[model samples]
Target chain A: TQLLEQSPQFLSIQEGENLTVYCNSSSVFSSLQWYRQEPGEGPVLLVTVVTGGEVKKLKRLTFQFGDARKDSSLHITAAQTGDTGLYLCAGPNNAGNMLTFGGGTRLMVKP
Target chain B: NAGVTQTPKFRVLKTGQSMTLLCAQDMNHEYMYWYRQDPGMGLRLIHYSVGEGTTAKGEVPDGYNVSRLKKQNFLLGLESAAPSQTSVYFCATGSIRRQPQHFGDGTRLSIL
Candidate 1:
């Protein structure tokens, strides 16, 4: 099984602070996806990175895929209260029909 | 658009009880998935279906079963509830294998 491991499982920061979460895997994947899940709701896809070393920005959030396609990272600039949520990284398995998700990094941006 | 909808937002059952979670989508997606989320465990796939009348086991399929009799609906069933099975359940749908999936709000089940 291909597993995605996330670092800093819990994060608490003040508004305006910057934070970055990392996701790593021993096996390479064809593509990787980032998701943010708020309380009481299912996860919402933030972005999908298909190319190695590719970076995509969504407002204040920036996501980067590893050069070897075995890791990824999510960076939030000037975090806000609304940015507080569980961030997860996932990638398709060998079958490519399903995804394996990371444990997730829970972020809390206090006002 | 009601991308994906899961019935029974919250449910509590005693041991050995049986129940089914219903997932319905209107986006004409061909692939549907069932996942369980636990604290610090991320979302684990329980079952999935590529199309109607076809279901496949996922990473963790023990104690659960799924059926997709219709293209837009997928059902997950628990034959005998166990305390270990208590978790938030989410249903998702996708048009293709590589596309981003659409997920429902989730159903919280508590097995007492």
Candidate 2:
């Protein structure tokens, strides 16, 4: 079983629409990170939330960490074609050394 | 600076063949990890090294071996490869301070 589960494996939306991607898990983590991967490229870090119930915003992107630290979410306002990519959420294992990633959400924003 | 890089971006191999994938990181990190990402599945860890001369098994370690002879390089080896091992392999490096891991583009391996 996957430790972290991401919903809406694929998403297609119009350029001015809004969307949210979720990453759920039963295990609690000390911290969680979000990444975006473009085609033929490696994943790049977007944001990291370390506190329970923490919410962070990067321009039009909003990220939330569950109060229990068992889940996280990414929200995009007025999505643009440039925001299209694979979004993945990851949290460290019990030892806080290695990370376990979600399946990922593939977002496609058409212009 | 190349934060992380993998060689042989694409490769095709026949069953029973052996090969090695090299990962180099210029971040001078102490932790390095190997992962394989299959369709419809999240990246699964194969092996990891905490420091030079030390290696440990991750979520999936069978049919794979790794070595960290130097602080900046980690190598993943497969002996007697099988078709089941075909997938996109990724290498990552990170620090212990909760810093996000930086990944390589990935190596597309196909075994027939």
* The best candidate in terms of lDDT: 1
How many pairs of residues collide in model 1?
0
lDDT for each candidate structure = 0.93, 0.90
Superposed model 2: Cα runs more than 4 Å off: B97-100
* Candidate 2 per-residue lDDT over residues A14-57, each given as its tens digit: 99999999999999988999999888777888999999999999
RMSD of each: 1.2, 1.6
Give the range of the ten consecutive residues with the poorest summed lDDT in model 1 chain B. Answer: B93-102
Error of 2 at A31 (Å): 1.4
User: What TM-scores does chain A show, candidate by candidate in order?
Assistant: 0.98, 0.97
Model 2 per-residue lDDT tens digits across residues B23-90: 99999999898999887686788999888999999888999999999999999999889999999998
Error of 1 at B57 (Å): 0.5
